[model samples]
Target: MHLISYITSRSQISEKSIQNTIELLNEDCTIPFISRYRKEKTGNLDEIEIGQIVQLKEQFEALEKRKVSVLKILEEQNVLTSDLKQKIDKTDDLTTLEDIYLPYKKKRKTKAETARKNGLEPLAKMIMSQRINDLDYTASKYTSNEVESSEKALEGARFIIAEWINERTDIRNNIRYQLERFATISTKIIKSKKEDEKAQKFKDYFDWSENLSRIPSHRLLAILRAESEDFIRVKIEIDNERALQKMEDRIIRSQNKCAEQIELAVADAYKRLLYPSLSNEALSIAKEKADEAAIGVFTKNLQQLLLGAPLGEKRILAIDPGFRSGCKIVCLNEQGDLLHNETIFPHPPQNRDTDAIKKISSLSDAYKIEAIAIGNGTASRETEQLIKRIHFKNEIEVFVVSEAGASIYSASKIARDEFPDYDVTVRGSVSIGRRLADPLAELVKIDAKSIGVGQYQHDVDQSKLKKSLDATVEHCVNKVGVNINTASASLLSYVSGIGPKLAENIVTYRNENGSFSDRKTIKKVARLGGKAFEQSAGFLRIKNGDNPLDDSAVHPEQYPLVKKIAKDVGKNISDLIGNSSELKQIDLNKYITDTVGLPTLKDIISELEKPGLDPRKKAKAFSFNQNIKSITDLHEGQLLPGIVNNITNFGCFVDVGIKESGLVHVSNLANTFVKDVNEHVALHQQVIVKVLEIDVNRKRIQLSMNYK
Candidate 1:
C-alpha cells in the first residue's frame, strides 16, 4: 500500500471512508456535490475535512511522481548503483530524496565538482578521512594542477570534501532536525535611528517577536509584509552549540580521526550550501503552518458571521439607498416574496413634502410593511431619515443593513432569472431589503469575499481565499435548512446536497412544473442522485405538508423508529415528537446498530423542537450620526464613532460613514502592544475612534484609541 493509504488505515478509519473522500475531491467532483450527496460514503465527513484530504492526496501523488522522475534521471546519467538504489527505495520523504540526489543532480559549475573532474579525487578523499598517520604522505600522493603550492593543494582538497559533506542526505537531514528542535525564532527591526514620519503605515511593526508555535497567523503574515516593504528585518535561529553537538553525533558515528573531517565538512556545508536551502525550507514550513492557522481563524470568524442572526420569515420593506438617485424600495411578503416595488425620493427636493409623504405612505399602507431595511451604503442614513419622517407604528424597526455586495448579486445571471422582468438596479435594491430579513438567503447570491468580512483579503493567495470562503458558505447553508420549493438557485446551492448547477436544475424544474408540495418531488431535478436525496431531503422543509416530519432534520431512515416510539407512547410520530418528556423516555439504544449512532439520534430530537426552524435572528438595529460623511469630516483628537467593517492583521478597518474606510493601527489599539487584531475587535462591531490623521488628498485616514 502507498504511504498515505497506509497512514489512513493506521488512523483506524474505514478504507471506504478514505477512498470516497479522495474520489469526491478528485478533479471529477466538486465540493458542493461531495458535501451534499456523498455523506454516507464518506461517513458524513464535512467539506473542511474533505478539502484537507484532497490537498494531502494531491501532495502524495506529486511526491510519488517526483520520486520516479528523480530515479529516472539518475539512471539516465549511468550513475545508478545498488547502494544508491537501496537508499532511494528506503527514503519516504521528498526532502531526504532530493538531498541524496544533490551531488549527482545536474547544476551550474562549482569549485569542488571542477576539482574532482580534474583528477584530484584521491587528494580530496585523503584530507576528508583526516587520519594523521599519513597526513603529508597522503597530500604528497597528488600534485597540483590549478593550485601552485601545498597550502593551495590542501585548500582545494578541503573544498571538495566540504561540498561532498554539504550535499550528504543523512548529514543534511540530521542538521535540519536539530535546528527545528532547538530553534529560537528571532525578529528584529533595523530602525532608522529616527522614525519615518512620512511613511506612517509601518511604524507599528518596527519591533516584534513571538515563538514559531505561539505566533498568531495574522501577526506572522503582518511581519512578512513589513519585511517585504523594507520596513523591518526578521530572522529565525536555534542554539548553535546544541545543533553542533547533535550534528557531531549524527554524522561522526564511527568516532575516528575521520570524525574531525566530518565535523569540518558538516560545519562548512551548513554555513555555505545547507543553510540557504534549509533556511528556505524551514521558512516554507512556517508559512504553511501560518496559512493553516489563518484559514482556521477565518473559519471561526465566518461561522460566527454566518450564524449571526436571521430575521426569518418576515415581511420586509427593503430600500437600496441613493442620494441624487431615488431610493429603490421593494416590499417582500412574509415568505420573502417581493409583493411590491417603487422609487421614492424623500430627500433634498421633496424633504417632508406632502407629495413625498403621500407616495411613501401609500406604498407602506398598501403592503402593511412590518419593517424597513435600509442598505448601509451611500445615502443610507438619509434614506432612513425619510422613513422616520412619517411614522408607521412603534413596533416597526428600521435596520441599517450591510449591502456590501448586494449590487454584484443583483447584476448576476442568477438574480436575473429570479427577477427577469425587473431591471438589475431594481433587483439590487430588492436584495438589499431582503438581506436584512434573511442574511443567509440574500448573501448566498454574492461571493463571500465580496461581503467584506476579512483582512488583507485581496493581498493573500487568491485561490486559497476563494476555497476557504466557499467552504464557509457551504457549512453555513447546511447548518440552516433551505425551503425545498421556494429557495432560489443562489440559496439552494448552499444546501447540504445541492450545488450551483443542481440548484439551478431544481429551480428550473420547479419553474416548469410549478411549486413542489413534498420533498420527494425533488427527485425529478436533473443530475440529482439517490445519495443526494437521502442526505438533503430531511433538511428541506414544506410548511404545509402531509408528512409533518419533513420539516425536521430526522432522516427518513429513522422514520420507522420514530413511528415505533410513537406507538409505544400511545401516540403518533407527529405528536410524540416536539415534546421533550415523550422523547426522553424512548429507548434509543434499542434502535442503535452500526449505521445509526447517538449523534444522529440527538440531532433528530433537537430538530423535533421547532421543525424547519431558522437558527438566526436580527440584533437590535441602530443608525449612527448622518453627518459623518467622509474621512475628510474628521480632525486630530476628534472622538468620531464608527462600525468595524473588518478585522485584519495590522489593525481594524472601520466604516465611519465614509466611501473609503479608515484604519486604526495595531499599536493604537491600547497603551500596551496588541498581538492579534481579532483579540481587540471583531467584524461588524461598532466602536469609538480618535482621529489621529487624515490625508484626504490620498484618501488615507488614520484613527487611534489613545487621544493626546
Candidate 2:
C-alpha cells in the first residue's frame, strides 16, 4: 500500500499534512519541533496530530517491510503468482497480510504434511470436490503399504482437507467475525491457591466473567495479572457451533457422501487448528487495546504531575518525616542548592520536641527560609502539626509535599552525581526540598513509573510505556521552556533535540565556562550540531541574556523576523518586548512570507506579549484537617479536605491527611453519571470530601464528593 495514503486514511489527516509530516520526520525533526516550528508546512497540526501521523507512518512502514519479506519467501519457494503478489502488495492490515501468506507459510511436521507424504493428496482433492458417489472405493484406491487400509486412508484424506479448510481466507474471516462480536472472557479460581494469602488480593477476579469487547481496561489488566500469578484460569469463549456452521456453509456444496467427509474435515479444522489460533488472536487484540488505554491514562497522569504548579525558586526547609529514624532535614537556596542538612526527631522514641523546635527555628532564621515543605510520608501529619505550633522568626508558609519517588531519586546515580558526599537520607531530603521548589525539574531525575501516579504501570508493555512517558516529559519540558543556566541535566535532556549525552555536554560546558548569556552561544557545546540547535534553541531560555528575545519561546532563526517586526513598529526590540499595545497594532498579514506564515507570525506576537512566562501556576500552601490523623479518626459523614494523588478508571484516590488514602468512587464523584474520572477531578486538585465509610482493619476509607 502507498504509505502516505494509508496514513491519511488511518489518521484522518489531510494527505498533504501527512506527506509533509513524514518528510519532516525523515529529515530527523522531532514531533515537538515539527509541530511548533513547521506549522505552515504541516497545515497547523498540533503535537497530538503530528504524533498520530508519526505512529501511523511507522506502522505502515513495518507492514511494507513484512510484505517484502513475505514476497521474497514466496518467490524462493516457486509459489508466487501475479495475483497473489498484487493481493499482498495492496493489503495494509498486518492480519490480512498474514492471512494471505498462511497457505504458503512453512510449518513443522503436522498431520496434514504426514498425510500428503503418504500419497493421500488426490483422495483429499476428490473428497473436497464433493462429486464422488463411492467414497470408500475412492479411498481404497489411495491405500498403500503406508496407508494400510481404506479407513486409515479416509482419516488421512480428512486431515489434508482440514488443513485446506483452515488455510481458506473466507473461512478464517468468518471465524474472526464470530470471535470479535461474541467473545466472552471468564476466569475460575485455581482451587489450590484460592486460600493462599498472596492470592487474596486478586480474589475479585477469581470467579469473574465479562464480555471481552466491553470489559474495562483496568479490569482486564487485573484479571490478566491474576492469571499470570497462577491464581486463576482464564478462558476466551464464543459460540463454537455458530462458527463451525458458517465455515461448513462456505465449504460444503453437495449432499453426497463426499459432503459428509468435508463436514468431518470442517469440524476437525474448527477444533484442532482454527479455534486455538483465532482465540489467541482475539485475546491478543483485546490485550493490545487494554495496554493502549492503560498507557494513555499513564501518559495523562505523568503530564499533569510534571506540569504541576512550581513553588518557584524559594528558600525551603524540607523534612523527610519518619518515626524511628527521625525526620531528615535539608535547607535549600532559591536555586535548589543544598545549604545545610541535619536530622530532627520531633516524634516518638526520641521525642525531642523542644530541641527539634529550637533547631528548626534556628535553621529557618539562619537560612532566611520562606517556606517549610514537610514530606507526606511516615509521621507527616504529626510533623505538620509540630511545625505549625512553632513560632518562627519569619512568616513561613508551611506546605506538605508528596514524597512519591524521593527515595528512588536519592538512590539513583543522578543523585550521587549531584551530591557526591551525601548519604541517601541527605539526598532524599534535598530531593524533597528541590521538588517543592520545582516539581518538574526535580521529578525528571526519577523514572515516571516510580512516581506512584499510574495504575498497573508494571503490568503494561514496558517499551510502549517508556516511549509514551518519555514523549510526555519531552512535551512538558518544551511546553515550559528550560532555563539554560539553572536547569538540571535531567530536565534539559527532555528539551526538543537534547538527549542525555547532549544534556551532559551542555552542563559540562556551563560548568567549565560561565553561564550562557545568549541562545547563540549554545552552538559552542561539543557534538551539538546545527540540526540539534534548530530543534532545541526555541525551547531553551536564557534569563538576563544579551538579547531580550533569547529568553522567549521564539526560535533563533526567527530573530531577524522579530527584529523586522519591531523595526516596522518604530520601536527597539527591548521597547517592544511585553508591549502588547504596539504588537496588536501591527498587521500580521504584512509579514507573511514563503517560509513564514500567519501561524508563525501569530505565535511570535503572542510570545512577545508574555515573554518567558511560565504556563504553570504558582504553588500554594494546603492544609489538611488537623483533627484527623489516621484512618481510625475518620467517621462517616464527616467532611475533610483532601488532595487527589492518583486516578484510575474506577475512581480517584484522595489523601486525607492520614496513613490510608480514601477512595472516591466514580459514581460518588457527582450526582450525574460520570463517564470519565478525569472530567470531575485532576491530579493535585484540592477538594473537600465527605467520609462515607471506613474499614479500620483493612485500612480503607471511602469518600464522596457529592455533598451540599
TM-score for predicted model 1 compared with the true structure: 0.77
lDDT (Cα) of model 1: 0.71
What tens-digit string does per-residue lDDT give for candidate 1 at 99-162? 8888888878877777676566777776555555645555555556565665555556767877
| Top-TM-score structure, candidate number | 2
RMSD of each: 5.8, 1.2
Q: Candidate 2 on 181-276: residue-level lDDT in tens?
A: 899999999999998988987888889888999999999999999999889999999988888888888988999998888899999999999999
| RMSD in Å for model 2 | 1.2
Model 2 alpha-carbon drift over 4 Å, by segment? none
Model 1: residues with Cα > 4 Å off, grouped in runs: 1-94, 100-104, 108-112, 132-159, 169-199, 206-215, 227-268, 324-326, 335-359, 393-395, 416-424, 459-461, 623-708
Alpha-carbon deviation at 655 in model 1, angstroms: 6.2
